[model samples]
Target: MSISLLMAVYNPIEYDGRVKRSANALAEICNIKVICPAQDFSSDCFNPDAFDVMRVLSPKIKIQALKQIFFWVNFIFQAIKLRPSIIYAHDYYLIFPAWLAAFMTNAYLVYDAHELIIPNQGERISKRDNFFYFLESRFIKSADLVIAANQERANIMGEHYELKKIPLVVRNIPPMPKQTLSDKLVFRLYEKLEHEYQEDIHIIYMGDINLDRGIGDLINSLKYLPMRYKCILIGGGPSESLIKLSHSQDIIGKRLRLLGPVPHNHIPDLLRQGDIGFLSYSMVGRNNIYCAPNKIYEYAQSGLPIISTSQEPIVSILRKYKIGELLPIKDKNTPLKIAEYIKKISFSNEYKHAIRKFLLDNPHKSEMDKLKDAINGVIN
Candidate 1:
C-alpha cells in the first residue's frame, strides 16, 4: 500500500508528535511518504525508517489569501506524481487540496485533524475565517475518514460541518519509553530534592509557552508564592506578554528560569526533574475548550502529577483519573492553590504507577491498529 501524508506546516516534522506517530505506525503496512512545506525535515528517534520525505514550496505564510490557492495547485501535481492510494491530510487547513487531489487521482482521502479550525481564532472572526468555514462546510464530507485528536473535537466537527459520519479520536500520545529507569538516577534525584532544597519546590512547565497558556499568570502567581518555590518554563513562543516579569525577582534566575525549547527526546528526563507539570491553556476559543493536549500524557508518563484548569476536555480526564489537580485559571486564589498543591503533592511510587496504568489501559497501540485498518481498508 502507498500513502502520502500531507502536513502543511512551517514546523519541521521531527517536532510534530501526532504526524510522527501516525507516520511511524502506518509504515508497518504501507510505504509512508510525508509531504511538507520547505523546512527542515530531519529524521529523529520518532521516525520508522519506512518513509521517504519530499519538500515543496508553494505559498509563504505571510501572504494569507494565496495559501490555499498555491496549496491546491502544488498538491495536485504531487498527488498525480506520487500516485498514492491514499492522500492523508494532517489537518483541516489542507483538506480541500487533499480532497481535490484524491478526487482527481481516485485516491482515498483522510482528514487527520489535530485541532479544530474554529471560527474567530484571534478573539474575533475575520473575513478569512468566514471563507475557511464556508469551504470546510462545503468540502469536508468528501473525506473518506475524519480523524480527530479527541471525541469532543470529533463531535464539534460533526455538528459544525453537518457531516453525517463522526470523526475517530486518535489521541496524540507519545511512544512508550525505550530506556530503562535507573535506580541510581532515581535515588540521586530523590536525595538531591530531599537534602539540597528540602524547603523549596521545583516545578516545570514544558511545551509551547504563550500568554494564552497562562505564562503571564504563572509568573504572576510566582510573586505570591514563597521565595523557596521556583519554576522553570521550558519552551518558547511570543514573549511580549512575559516582558513585565523581566524586572521581577523570579526572572532574575533565582526563582524562575526560561529555558528555550530542547530536543523532543529530552522531555521525559526533563519531566523527571520537576515536581509538577502545568497544562494551563485559556479556554477562549472552541479549539482550546476541546483540546486534548499531549502534554498531560507526557507529564504523567514521566511520573509527574499535572496542575491544570477546570476546563471541559482536560478537566474531565484529570478529574476522572485523579492524576492531576484542576483549578480556576485567573482567580485570586489560583496561585494559592498552585502553591498548596506543590507543597502538599505526594509524588509516591504507587501514585505514579496508577497514572501509568491509566495511560497503559488507553495506550497509543490502538492508534496504530486503527490507522493501519483505515489505510488498508482504502487500499483494498
Candidate 2:
C-alpha cells in the first residue's frame, strides 16, 4: 500500500527541514509520495530522489478563495491519476481537497494537524476563516486517523471534535546523522565570514523572519551587547524591513547580517559556524505557545546552546534537560535577560557540556518510532 501526503504551503519549496527528514526516514519503511500545489515561485531545493514529487499547475491568485478553488481542481485531477491506499493531508486547507478525492476513490483519509487551524472564536475571525474552520472540524473528526504536531494542539482539536482515539503527537525533531563537518568546509566558511566582518561570536537565527518571531527584540538586544557579538538572520518574511531599521538605528552594519533565505540543507553548516542558536516567538496565541519548532532540535543537534522564550513543551524540555535558558516573552526586560543568559552560557563549560550531551543522546528516536507506528496503524 502507498501513502500520499498533500501539503498546502506558501512556498512549496520551503519544505520544513524536519518534515523532509521525517518523510525521507518514513520512505525507508513505506512507499510514499508527496503532492504539493504550485506557488508563486518554484525551486530545485526539494529532493526529487527521496519521494515522487507531484506538482499541480495553478495560476497564482492573490485572493485566498480563488487559490483554494484552483488548488482543489488540480488536486482532484492528480488524485484520480495516483490512487494511493491512504491520503494524508498536512494542514486543514489541504484536507477538503483530499476528502473530496478520498470519497470518490474510497481511500483512507488522515489529517496531519501541524497547527491549531480553528481560530479562537472570541478573536476577530473573517467569514472565510470561519468557513474553513467549519470544514476542517468536520473532515478532521471524520478522518480514519489523526496526527498532531504536539500534545497541546491535539488537546485543542479534541475540545471541538468527538474523536474516538486521541490524535498521535509527532514532535518535529531532526534525524541525527552521524556526520561531521569537513575541516576544509568549516575553515572556508569561517574565512569568508571573517573577511566580511571581524572575528566575533556569530549568533544565528534560521527560520521565518516575521514580526512575531521577535526580530525587533533581537535587534534591540544586540544594541545593548558588545561589538564582538554579531547576528546572522538566515530566513525571509515580512520583517526584512527590520534590516533597514537596524542600519538606520546605527547598529553596526558588520554586526548584523541578513542572508536572505538559504536552502534548507545549507542551514546545518550555517548553524555549525555560529557560537549560539536562537529561537524566539511571541506567545500571542496557543499555536505560538505550543510550537515545537524544527530549529530548536536542529540547534540541539548542532551542539549549540539555545536562548528561547518560556513557551510550552520547549520550555519544559529546556528546563528539565538543562540544555538551554528561557526568558519570559512579555517581560519588559526580556532582551536584557536574554543577553545575560547568553553571557552566562557563553562562559560556562557546564552549560556547554549539557548541550553536548543532549546532542550526543539524540532523543528523537522514540518520537520517530511513534510516527512509524502511526503510519503503520493507518495502513494496517
lDDT of each: 0.71, 0.72
Q: Which digits, one per residue and each the tens of the lDDT, describe model 1 over residues 96-131? A: 788788888888888887767766534566677666
The alpha-carbon deviation from the true structure for residue 336 of candidate 1, after best TM-score superposition, in angstroms, is: 1.3
- Alpha-carbon shift of residue 133 in model 1 (angstroms): 2.1
Q: Determine which window of 10 residues in candidate 1 has minimal summed lDDT.
A: 187-196
TM-score of each: 0.86, 0.88
Best by lDDT: 2
| lDDT, candidate 1, at 174 | 78
> Over 4 Å off in model 1, which ranges?
1-11, 40-48, 57-71, 120-124, 179-200, 224-226, 346-350
Q: For model 1, which pairs clash?
A: none
**What value does the lDDT take at residue 36 in candidate 2?**
67
lDDT of 2 by residue, 149-263 (tens): 8788787777768778878888787776444556467556544344244447777887788756786777777777888888778788876578677877787457777776765
Looking at model 1, residue 159 earns an lDDT score of 83
Question: TM-score of predicted model 1?
Answer: 0.86
